[model samples]
Target: MRIRTAGVVAVLGLALAASGCGDNSKDEPAAKDSPKAASGKLVIWADDKRAAALKPFGEKFGQENGVTVEVQAVSKDLQTNFVTASQQGSGPDVVVGAHDWIGNLVQNGAIDPVQLAAEQKSAFNETAVKAVTFNGQVYGVPYATENIALIRNTELAPEAPKTIEDLVASGKKLKAEKKASEILCLQSGQNGDAYHIYPLYTSAGGYLFGTAANGDYDPKDLGVGKPESIAAFQKIAKLGEKGDGALKRSITGENSIATFTGKKCAYLVSGPWAIADAKKAGIKYDISPVPGFAGGKEAQPFVGVQSFYVAAKGKNKALAQEFVTNYVTKPDLAVALYNAEPRPPALTAAFDQVKGTDPDLAKFSEAGKNGQVLPAIPAMAAIWDPFGKAEAAVIGGADPTKTVTAAGKTISGQIK
Candidate 1:
């Protein structure tokens, strides 16, 4: 993938930060214990991308405050590692994670509620904050947000389809001319991806969880097998059957991007991460909201937010709060982060800065304007497995309604 100029600048900033930063690992003497220092050390665990980006900031913060900052890039399982490390009193002072993981993190007592200043609160996306809120308490600071939208290869279809019928018709045209493999490309592995497929379900007016008085997801009101979900699945099943079941278990994020960029498919439902590759392949594309099904509502994908959370068990809570609230939340930092990664910014001002620069991001923001935040309730852990199986059943030729209904019952029972 060809890296954009903005992306290059972001990477350079991160590289500079990583090299200039001081070691703040536990192995080092506590800065406070050193007579010349002002405070203590702060440890942070982040994914590789974030870790690289934050290294320079860490070095700067450490130097400015006389407190050392340690950054470790843990690639595999953040949640599992956080839980295990916290129990051993060796976890990070702060963690970078997703909002949906709030439920489990809170339940496990692995994170603490963050108390943002009123001004700080105003600077963030309310919906992003709400995603990390559980039982009336806020737990994380969101840095970025994401959602899927319809991305069409302009070479194959110059204009984006406004409805499922339009998408299907375009697909049929491509197939007739042997220009495409299928009308719509979706992932349907044994464990189906309900998150990515959510737009299709919502387009049919189905929802996985109902809302409460406060708009929090009501776990008891499971809607997996709702008539709308079934209808939506049936529509996709019909397309799968007619197209030789091209939407198979093997189809993944990588493959989906390939299909569109390779010009083998006209429309792909994806997020901003695919932009670099799409551009590099020299394929012209435009994004739009996922179209609604017949007699159904507009397709609304689940909105996801990437956030930072203070560790309740951290030894340096005050310093961690200072870093997140004072430094990371600034417009300059926010803009740098967004430009580096190109997801929707949680801060409105920062978001507005680059909103016009990236068309893909703008389309995603539009698509998510009416989208529901993915349920962060702990019960969501039980929904993914069974619901995915039901989607697989539909793709495998079983009745959509029956499969989804069974899956819903199983999920509800497990939660109970």
Candidate 2:
């Protein structure tokens, strides 16, 4: 979950990128049409990563329902496009996307609540179901989950760093020995990465939003500028170039993979997405929870679940609901999706099938054992810009207290 929303513009950045694609109208359906227009058809939009895996399942569902089922890859701006298409009544009947889209999709009236039987819901990871629920309504069927963890070059460090200070000390030694060029591979280029830095902030007692009575995130309780947040960043600032030189804005997402793969860094704070590249680079790595500061709490990453949702505006409402809550919830389908991307599956059966088979997967789950469910509230849309900029300033040698305080005010004002 670390840096999951890095560099996002509003809540529209990298976090939702997995929801699907399309940059312009040429790619988007120009007019919304009811799924009713094609009375016997069903469609699902997904990011390219899941399209191939879903095609066979779509064929099976179509065969059973006697309706055509197409799993389309929207590869660009899935969240915005789906809603845009929905307003015009032309969106797909179903969409495979990130759970956090629930709030925005509901706000746009693009999705309907999914009715999962208690027995069926009981088969999923509790955190996953919670991620797709909004205001007490289950809006999506979760299939897979992901969160960032510490991917360390074992040959270099051999053991996981006990604390943030220890990690920095080890990194500095590696740099001094000319064994690496960078201290760490956690990206912070320019705007800074709030997602990646969240654990540190939290370990220092910072929080993004307060919890509502029902355990949902309350945007009204903005914490970006609170005293704890400032103290957290002050600690982070001490690790930057002017201080320990453990972090730098130059290590961006675009370069992080290469930095770690090239042996330019000993540890990379990243998600499962980088595993393949590390293998290709032949780097012997280990996965563990990202360590926290010495005096802080245990590090916690943000938990994100990828899910399937039914479009409220679709013509095949009944069939769409049937596909999402019934068909997509199966353990086999969940495992297939996991095989395609290697993220931990959300289905309890599927998770049990894979956990013992892959130590890496188990490690990620362990790392996020007490992670924050990436808040799905609409107010998250207003937090990215100001908070990210403030983090950038602090990392670049600015005052943590002033920068974090100003960011909190900006977020509160925007929420109001």
Candidate 3:
């Protein structure tokens, strides 16, 4: 499988979403292709955003090591592409992708664990390091971290919603005044969207999996079918169209941002990715935690980290390790990647440097301050479609108990 450029990445991006918890680990049978190895050289694959900034460092590494270093752009479906290529013994020495890719990558034997010193690990945000660490080893060197947060229109609701109820109440009043067409742009589509709804789910006491004693996700501890999940979705159902009409199926993933940008909604539960559109639409917005249910637990969004992994089957394994462990771990590279992508830098020094220049990054970092590290275990893949459909069904007025209960069964079957 050949890797494509940034302009055509949707398919690769959907690979993981199609398969499980992310775009990086999308489900596909492994395909073996010939290795594209260049003699006496080191190759690194990454998205376009980081390639340019990484070039100089790659060259510097080559100069010091007396080897040619190629920084290739594998802008599309990087994680899946890397995996498939690895199967054929034909992937780059290093691959840059989301931290969540660890589970599937490790399962496919595509990436080698990156060994970082204690201080080296401490140099990064703990969450980034944790996301890259699966089981007992770290497989990637993280550069940045990101998560969703509430983006509210300042003019429509000056103060941040203290709770999810406050957000809904304010929206309903605005709806009554004909000032807004929707209550909120949370976007539960026809089939449901677990990602967008996770804050509310967790706030109402839902969890996907519990951590092992070692602090890694324990696949055996499934949370979807448990009573806590049922209780959580029951609360989620109340906000659906069948009950308070706060969460409408009409507010789909495609339209939520548009709806918010058009001023049809006072609040939008989204990530930093949505900020550009808000700025373009000239909406007066402020970032905050996705408010929880009134008097309930604090809302928690899933935290994601973007990092560099050394491909286990690369042509040059030792060089791959050197590149990831020594070259990619720098604070400047972290800052450079952040400039290209604008997520929170994982390295403390980079984060400190950027936070002074970009307050929005700081705001978002705080928004996900207490957020849960999104589970990267293979079991996590099973929860997406089943849970999404169930949530959508509940939002559309189906019995939350029956719908969520059935969805839990589906997930259990897959994981089993």
Tell me, by TM-score, which candidate is best. Answer: 2
Q: Work out candidate 3's RMSD over C-alphas.
A: 8.7
**Model 2 off-target regions past 4 Å?**
1-38
Candidate 2 positional error at 401, Å: 1.3
lDDT of 1 by residue, 198-256 (tens): 88777767778898998888998888877867777877676554344545666775587
Tell me the lDDT of candidate 3.
0.81
**Which portions of model 3 miss their true places by more than 4 Å?**
1-38
Superposing all C-alpha atoms, what RMSD in Å does each candidate have to the true structure? 7.6, 9.6, 8.7
Write model 3 residue lDDT over 1-416, tens digit each, in one string.
44533221111111111111111222321111212224546778887768876877776656555566778887678777888889988788888888778898999889888756665777889889889988878888899899999999999989998988888899999999998988899877888888889989999999999888888888888889899999998998889887778898888889999999999999999888898899999998999888999878989999999988888888887667666776677777787787777899999999998898887898899989999998888888898899999998888888878888898889989999
Best by lDDT: 2
Q: Which has the higher TM-score value, candidate number 2 or candidate number 3?
A: 2
- lDDT, residue 368, candidate 3: 95
- Among all windows of 10 consecutive residues in model 3, the one with the lowest summed lDDT is 13-22
List clashing residue pairs in candidate 1: 17-56
lDDT of 2: 0.82
Q: Candidates ranked by TM-score, best first? A: 2, 3, 1
Q: Candidate 2 on 298-409: residue-level lDDT in tens?
A: 8888999999998998888877776776677778899899889999999999999888877899999889879999999999988888888888888889998888888888
* Model 1 regions lying over 4 Å from their true place: 1-39, 242-247
